[model samples]
Target: MSAAARAVVDTAALRHNLLSVREAAPGSRVMAVIKANAYGHGLVEVARALADADAFAVARLDEAVALRDAGLAHRIVLLEGVLRSEELSRAAALRLEPVIHCPEQVSALEQASLDNPLRAWLKIDTGMHRLGFPPGEAVGVARRLMASGALAKPPVCMTHLACADEPEETVTRSQLAAFAGAVADLPGDRSAANSAAILAYPESHMDWVRPGIMLYGVSPFEGRCGADLGLRPVMSLSSPLIAVKDVPAGGRVGYGGTWTADRATRIGIAAIGYGDGYPRCLGSTDTPVLLGGRKAQLVGRVSMDMIAIDLTDAGDAAVGDEVTLWGADLPVEILASRAGTIGYELLCGVTQRVAVSYV
Candidate 1:
């Protein structure tokens, strides 16, 4: 039989999460951030499932193009904007909004055809040093986009929140202040809130609310998890327990003997591992899993194709019993924490070998 390790996409749950996001930011437009292949939930499938979504946000040009080719008529916002001048015409034709963040992008947009001047969002660097014009120069960029005869309409002003997830930080408030000050005179609607802002800071929700992780039912706050927020998990990773063995006390297991049995134990081998997007950094022990509705503990390092779960209580477990590596049974955040990472990395890093099964 084919390997049983799989990442299951929950379509109904995805729709439910989108509704929750809308509920969180009532009346405001919602741009579902489906980047990173919809947080590894399967982009096309999530896109299809959330067809009623107000708009979709992606990072690269190809992702936007793919949506267009898929006959998705909703607005697709390119977060990185146009990387090259050639993208302008295509973006215009596809009706994708490019989030112009730099002078090179502006020059490319100016050089592109005017007939289908693309809709654009101007990103201002409030505090996040990653991208966008400095706060002082944002107003000028907005004006330039409007003045360009090639442009069809005024640009929307936007800024990314540097620390919206951390409510205690003054950064989010500072960012909001900067955004408000810079776009004071700019003529189009503005957006600044990410998932955290949409949830924790209502004042940040302006013309548009961009929710990425929250749409996937993940908690934006660090040290917290989706379950803590009443959000349902949309991805459940599972595999079968294919082997069972009895190990004596003091027996060593897995690579480099990272884990050792302290007493008589039953080890159930689950066909999931780092190669399947499970965290390699998760210690040989202390990692958690669910087997047949019971908690199981990892007793060895995650291998390329399997994880050994301590199943002393699972005397009934057999070859085909389902083992949950994450989701449903254990929150992805919990797994990510034990793995020393975040849900984004764990989701997006699922390797190719594991067959993805959508539920």
Candidate 2:
């Protein structure tokens, strides 16, 4: 581990979170999305953690290859279909399922003749309108893939729900209606729910639930926390107190001199900063770290390698005492809310400058 900052990933906690996903969607297959290096928890690590995951989903073909190279045997789905005609062969060779969202993807699949044709998902453009065949065009596109024998089996009908997080909203139901109508009488499974739907909209959990942030132990609901959903945080962004000193009343510390002591105070220098993915903006008028398990206010602007925290009542905290940026006792949602962002951003933003130690 690096001397200044450390990120510890708990494999046990990861397993617990996957179990929670299954518990929430007891009947549906769990297609755990491990893209963006498993939301910055390290791709291979998170994939290994969810060993029993029904399948894995990545944004591209290269990510699917990475898992296969790592000896991961779970079915892999490429959320974005092949980028070119050549990739279709590689994808089929790897037994990777591509979500053919656009007409071009269907064209690429049609061009390829694999000994083992690929099993693919047909993405329908619902209200999100991000990718995929328009809902009205879904059936025709699917029929072409089916008749051509480019696909090994019927395409899995899928659509993204824009408002599944808002439980009372009717948008998801409408999207499901449109998606179901297009794939009607199509003898294949359907996948619609994301992490939010797996937890909040059980009806949307048709055949598979694609969970992203939830696998990293983050809640989809605004007021709720991951812990409340029986999820455990997989990463602990921790650092040690490098130094501590006394500052006279009205004295300022660190860059910009933004925080001036109102009374005689004890100041602590934490050895990780924005360079290590700790939010620099959080230094002023935002959440800080916990010291000796007591809340401490951050002081001044964060430096490239250090941040100062006003620790007046931190109470005899030593130079090497552990400081939690977020994990365990300090919920990431708490820090994210105070930073005017979300946990997903903060978690994925953890930079490579920090050392990562797996547990």
Candidate 3:
């Protein structure tokens, strides 16, 4: 049976992107970030494909549990750390590492009594004020964890780069400096680089590099595609032209009548929309999709389960012809730009209904 919409994941491209990460940061160990179900590329599936990763990092404990349940023995780091004391035991039992980002988490580790201590990471908030301990408090927090004996070893000191994607920005340099100064005296491996830093800031790739978007072969920077960084795209979103017809010059298309046919126009209705994670905000004539390998414009407001494509140029396009939403040929970044979002959201936004096939 043919799926209405499908996302094709290329395992080889994923491995190839991993190689790209290695080539960019040859000296650093990779902690592949597979959070958000491997950025919607299927969690356990991507892990199995990139089994060579030094460790895997996810945003939540359940994600780590999913990986563990899948029989993946790779070291998994919970980026958000455990929320409560009870989760600590499960995290410990699963042999999962949690990022000690706050005083409460530190307190939890201090009070918990576990048979086996957990190997953990200490996140210092250099500039990205979202998580982690403040710079001055980082050393103190590490000491507290060490004094508690909850950690199997010295915690791996780490921080996130807020502006690493913007190479010309001074914030990245300041954040790097702050992180270095904060953890200089700490006795453990240090990590700071994300996908953007791995490719641009070699100095920040201290001990571990967390490649998230790049692992799925998407660029972390604006105005750049993964191909520019020697990475192959892993996911190709495609659907079939399920219906085709001609509309009169004065006729309006789709909901709200936002688009009107200026001339006799041929339209193709593709089986993809916001319901399938295709951006509804992308209902514009400027938005492009490939119909039978020819360029076509998206017209009118996107419906729940379909998008109308102006097939004026691709008059030869017929029902059942493949229409590519985004892929190696049409970068998701382009579509994301049209939708006023980033490639990351588009990749992660793919819904459950869309069938995923691995190559």
Which one wins on TM-score?
Answer: 3
Candidate 1 Cα deviation (angstroms), residue 299: 0.8
TM-score of 1: 0.96
Task: Show where candidate 1 strays beyond 4 Å.
Answer: none
The TM-score ranking, best first, is 3, 1, 2
Q: Candidate 3's residue-wise lDDT over 1-359, tens digit each? A: 37399999999999999999998899999999999999999999999999999999999999999999999999999999996878999999999999999888988899999888999999999999999999999888888999998889999999999999886869999999999899989998999999999988889998899999998888899999989888899999999989999999988999999999999999899999899999888886389899777888899988889999989898688889988999999999888888888999999999999999999
Give lDDT for model 2: 0.86
TM-score of each: 0.96, 0.96, 0.98
- As for candidate 3, its clashing pairs are none
* lDDT, candidate 3, at 113: 94
Better of 1 and 3 by TM-score: 3
Q: By TM-score, how accurate is candidate 2?
A: 0.96
Off by over 4 Å in 3: 1-3
Best by lDDT: 3
RMSD, every candidate, angstroms: 1.4, 1.5, 1.0
